[model samples]
Target: MAATFRRAMDALYLLCVIVGCTALVLISAIIPWAVFTRYVLNSAASWPEPLAVLLTIVLTFIGAAAAYRLNLHMNVGYFADQLPQPFRKLLELLVQILMALIALFMIVWGESLVEVTWHNTIADFPFLSVGVTYLPIPIGGLCLLLFIVERIWLGIPPDPIPAHHEVAPFE
Candidate 1:
């Protein structure tokens, strides 16, 4: 059962990575186009800048969740590492609890925010709801919550396998 759950989560993690990377690439591409249209082409489109901002929000939240799952999120663990084994373990639990709390806060507040803004359309995009842009917050929070719960229950997985192109020292 645990193995099955982990496999499912691994798939979800891959999905997060795909979404985040795609958003990031889109942002990179669109920003340049926006700039080109404004300075070079002498005609700026209203949608690109706002669209880039929306994509940025998506990239940040989704990428952050993926980072957390991969244990790539930033932390100051030097002191924690120096502590005795038991103390280190306790500190780990404490940290996980705090993370869980933050995720919970995001879930509650983010949903409220989404609800409040759902009816309002974005200024530049008449058909799009402002709340749609805010979706990453709550969705990322839920993803983070799932990962935190899994960590609390089964502990963090080992580092992921390196990509094919990565150099191996012994090779």
Candidate 2:
């Protein structure tokens, strides 16, 4: 059962990474086109800016959930590491509990936000509902909650990538 759950989460993490990367790529391509059209072509395109904003939303929320699952989210662990072993474990549990609460908050409030905006259409993309763009909020929240459960239940999974490779810093 645990193995199955972990496999499911692994799949979900992959999906999140793919979606986030795609959004980022689209944003990169769209912004350059928008700039080119506005300056070089002398006529601005109406769709790119708003589309970029929407993709940014996806990148932020969905990417964040993937980061959290991989234990890559920003955290200051120096103080916790300095504590005694039992206290350190306690603090870790406390942090997970806090994160779970935050996930629940996102699920509840984000759903309400989506429902409120569901009927509204974007001016630039008239066929797309505003609420559809906000979907990543709740979806990411749910993914976060599942990952939190996995962490609490199974402890941290082994890093998929081996740690022996050295990272080179950019000049």
Candidate 3:
């Protein structure tokens, strides 16, 4: 069941990437058009700038989620390596808990931000409001929280990592 749940999460992460990646390509293409129209033709494609900005916001959030799922977030493993086996497990748990708490706080704060944005629309890019732009914060927080929970589950006493890591004490 645990493996199945992980696979489901992996699939969801892949889906987010597929959508985000496609938008990223579209955004990259749009900026050139926006620039060309504004400079070469002396007119701006108003939607392009707003569209590009929107995609950038989405890309950042989705990327964070993907990195968290893949365990690619910035972490200091060398210091963790020096600790004794039992202590290492304890430290890992502590780190995961800290991450979880941080994510939770972000979620709360992000929700409030989103609420404010929804109520207050933008004037320049009025079509694209702050609520839409700030979505990454809450979404990323939720994703990172999930990953930290998974990590905590595996880092408990007796540690669920592979045998090789257990034997090496530093692996």
Candidate 4:
């Protein structure tokens, strides 16, 4: 059961990474194009900014889930690290509980937001429902909830991926 859970979580994390990276590349290209169209061509594009914002929302939420699974989320461990082992463990548990609560809040409120905005359409893209834009919120929260459960009930994730090879800068 544990193994299956881990495999599932890994797959989810990989999916999030792919989505986030795709969004990053797309946003990078779109912004420059928007700028060029606005300044160089003297005809500002209407779709790029709104599209970029949507992509950013997706990237931030999904990337955050992946990062949490990988233990890449920010940590201010100086104070906690100074505590004794038992206290440290307690603190860790406390943090996980707090994170789980936050994830739950995201899921609950995000769904409400999505439902409330379901009938509305993006200003620039009238055909697209605004609710669709908010989907990443609950989806990411779901992913995060799973990861937090795994961490609290299962165990710490393995170490970070090791570099495949060392490259010399001069080479």
Per-model C-alpha RMSD: 2.2, 3.0, 6.9, 2.3
Question: For candidate 4, lDDT tens digit of each residue in 9-54?
Answer: 8888889999999999999999999999999999999999999999
How many backbone clashes are present in model 2?
Answer: 0
Winning model by lDDT: 2
Give candidate 4 regions above 4 Å deviation. Answer: 163-171
Model 3 earns a TM-score of 0.77
Task: Give the Cα RMSD of candidate 1.
Answer: 2.2
lDDT of 3 by residue, 1-171 (tens): 777766666676777678679878988899999999999999886788877887887777777766666666687799899989999889878877887888998799988899888866666676667887788888878877876666565422222235674476645
Candidate 3 residue runs with Cα over 4 Å from true position:
154-171
Q: Is candidate 2 or candidate 4 better by lDDT?
A: 2
Error of 3 at 111 (Å): 0.8
Span of 10 residues, lowest total lDDT, candidate 4: 162-171
Which clashing pairs does model 4 show?
none
Model 2 misplaced stretches (Cα beyond 4 Å): 166-171
Instruction: Give the best candidate by TM-score.
Output: 2
**lDDT by residue for model 2 over 78-134, one digit each (tens)?**
999999999999998999999999999989999999999999999999999999999
Lowest summed lDDT window (length 10), candidate 3: 153-162
TM-scores for all predictions = 0.93, 0.94, 0.77, 0.93
Task: Go through the candidates in order and give each one's C-alpha lDDT.
Answer: 0.89, 0.93, 0.75, 0.91
